[model samples]
Target: MKDKYDVVVVGAGPAGSITAMYAARGGCSVLLMEKDRDIGMPVRCGEAVGKDGLNGVIEIRPEWIAATINRFRLVAPDGAVVEPDIGGTGYVLERRVFDYDLAMAAVEAGADVVTKAYVNGLWKESVNGQERIVGVTYTWKGIPRKVRGAVIVGADGVESRVGKWAGIDTTTDFRDMECCAQMTLAGVHMEENACEFHFGSRWAPQGYLWVFPKRHGMVNVGVGISGMAAKTRKPMYILEEFIKERFPRAGVLTTVAGGVPCVDTLREIVKNNVVLVGDAARQVNPVSGGGIAGAMQAGKIAGEVIAGAVASGDMAELEDYPRRWEKLRGARNRTYYRMKKAVFNLSDETLNSIASSVLKLPREKQTIWGVFRTALVKRPSLILEMARTFGLKERE
Candidate 1:
């Protein structure tokens, strides 16, 4: 790699790769680094992404999709199921292939891509009594190397060290982190176009169980529980018990365990010459524990902002990153975080009653919000609090 570049992005996931692609396309010299030997090895995601969320970002390859989902089955504690048709379907992708393809796109766009390069920390320098990021020091092939840059982008995951090294507060509390365990199983009987979600404090306290079908009768069954629940019992233990009881005849293929940040956006994500994206910025959906779409969207914006700053030689232009992201995604994240807190605090009786009401609605209108509103309508105080918290009145 060169001694210096216009921009250096850590991590080669969707966010980092897209940032590199956009920056390079805008005519900035860019370098994208990944610690893993392979671009997408050791996958840790549920692998489901919305269709519209990825359309213009990257072209979808037929071989990368395991299944296309159009319908949802939301199951309550009492086994009450609400089926709904959600248009603009989603897909469970082969993340390994998908990640590599995204990185290749960045390389094709003129960014240099490197793997097995671990970033130890940010190289900081003081310019005129102010701290600024100058470059990164990392170990590659067991040798230390330094690359200087005018800008750095942290596209790292939830536990991002780059942000911390750059003085950005990237800490997430246990309550905001979702402990998850998933297993890909064969011989599982499931509908190809239907995704199942099981909700209950018993099944997955503070979170939910999901089943996304893959090709050839294989399915990815997973559960996410709040860190509080996980402290009492391991998330894998909860998942194992549920699977043994529900799918006694299924065969396991692969297992994965990881944490998902279900918190609101970080208080700050950009500083000086550096910016944070993807889970590093806590941009994942607070309710769904999904970050693919948010990461890609954030990467696109960060890329444009960084490119402008590099071209203009103005550090002030970099400050626009957080403002743009907040305008687009901050309110939704705040609303979802509140909704998650409320749902996790519900009693089993309340959940059952909500499920019954939800089942009474037509499939098209059977949403979690509908159930929440129906069950809590009698308590006008609670309704009003929710309305104010989510800015629902403005939406209405």
Candidate 2:
């Protein structure tokens, strides 16, 4: 809207909105742009968020939630099952509403927010023999426009052209990408207050399948398969087949397909005067492929760091973005990456064995940590890393 601002954030998803909101609240001029006509149209997520994780970054609103979850059902190949208290609240969000509200929050915080504003490229200039991004070029409401800023934030999703333009390598390894497909179904019979996870080659080879309640009698059923596994079968086909077998009479209401970066945080997130956040920075949980909560947290950190840099007129302060992020989640995500590798190698029989063992315990003793501990029965050292990362004792 304006020709210039203190911060220009691309992709008005959770990360961009949060970054813009905080930066504006911190007294920096901020612009949040969304390429799509609607701020949160065509949702591309599982739409599930852990209570503590979401509340840590933003307040929870009942209107933005679809279902409240406090427990999880885990199903192994042999159909052995265990239901564990997720330890806190969980919510399947009405993402479109959630995203729109977040963007409005940014606007209320004094950031200019716009939709249908396609950012085509970055405005880069050379300084001291090195190129740096100073702003962005976009088509706002079908009119070509350019805006300048002291710092740029790329909250673009999996296909991050802004990061590419800023010379921040945003590519995820083929093997580390998860090809995902999800469909919201009506008239499905499942626990309304619980989320379910299914595992095995027959269900979701090289990845996991999830069933999350959206509303009473309605659920979002999805499957994420490793990029390697996708080479053999389509994720959507797998999902459809499972739906026919599991919820034969249910009606498909909506379908979504996308990729999730199942890798550790990028080695570099901030470069020069630009920083990458959310899916652009590969901030999703390496083990679960969940990015909503991580994106919010990363956005908050980036906003504060960029605001300080703007206040002092010292671009060098931008470097604190990555350092602060590392302290918050980067280190723990690396541990999750290793855990992903270890879990991926486990055989179907092994998973069933673990599930059986977990089921044998008293209902209350069959906890999420107990399941994690069973997976690391061989690599006890990795258990230490897991314990430290999760703030749980190894014995738990």
Candidate 3:
């Protein structure tokens, strides 16, 4: 690896790889580093992406997809259910292959990609009486190496240290955190073209449980509980118990555990010469804790901004990263955060009632947006909030 580059992005996930690819394509020397020996091994995500969201950033390749989803069910505690079409499309990705392909794309775009490289610290220097990160120090192949860059991008996941090291406050409140556990199971009987979500204190305790199809006869089932509730019962145990009762004979294929930040986007994402993206910047949806699409979108913007700065030798351009992201997604995410806070407080009976109401709607009208409005029945003012955010008439 070179001793110096224009951009150094940590964490070879979708966000980091896309950032590296775009920056390199923009004519910046970029380095992408991954601590894992394989780019996407031991995947930590739910592996689902919205059709429009995915297409907005990258072209969808048939090889990267495991299952196609056109509809989803939302089940309440009382078994009241509502089926909603995702506008006839979505995909559950084979994240391992997808991430590896993204890294290779970055390499093809002129960035150097390295695996098994763990970033241990940042390279900082005193500038105008302040410590500013100029690069990073990482260990590759059990050997330490230092690389300097004009800009640094931290796409590390929720447990990132790079942002903190760069003096950005990356702390999240326990209430806003969802402790998650997932298992890929075979021998499960579920719709191969649909996904399922269960909501109630019993099922997930303030968060939600999801069952997404991986392929025929295979499903990814998981639960995300509020951090506070998770202290009382492990998320894995909760999911396992649910599975035993729901699909007793299912065979486990793989298990994953992690945390999802379900809060409003951070007020700050850029610090001096460094910028945080993906989970590091809390870009995940505050309601669903979905970050794949958000990460890729943020990475795209960050790359363009940083590359422009590098080319012009004006690092101040980095500030555009957060502004652009807020315009693109963070603003809507804040509305979702408000909706989450309001909905998560409803009684189980209330959620069942909402589900029942949604079920009564015309199939075409029983959309996610309809579900959101149903959830806001008690907090009707939030309906106005949503309308304002989306430029919809209050009646709509």
lDDT of 2 by residue, 1-396 (tens): 788999999999999999998899889999898999888889888899877677667788889999888899999999988899975478899998999999999999999987888999998788799876779998977799889989999999898888788777888888889999999899987778889999999888879999999876889899998999999999999999999999999999899999999999888898888889999999999898899999999999899889999999998998888998898889989888877876765679878988988887788888898887776774565567656655565563
CA error at residue 188 for candidate 2, angstroms: 1.8
lDDT of 2 at 78: 94
Candidate 1, pairs of clashing residues: none
lDDT by residue (173-275, candidate 1, tens digit) is 9877899999888998778888898888878888889988888988889999888888897889888998899888899888999889999989888888888
- TM match of model 3 to true structure: 0.93
Per-model TM-score on C-alpha atoms: 0.93, 0.93, 0.93
**Runs of candidate 1 exceeding 4 Å displacement:** 126-130, 362-364, 367-369, 378-396
For model 2, what is the alpha-carbon lDDT of residue 108?
94
Clashing pairs in 2: none
Q: Which window of 10 residues has the lowest lDDT sum in candidate 3?
A: 387-396
**Scored by CA lDDT, what does every candidate get?**
0.86, 0.88, 0.88
Candidate 2 whole-model C-alpha lDDT, 0 to 1 = 0.88
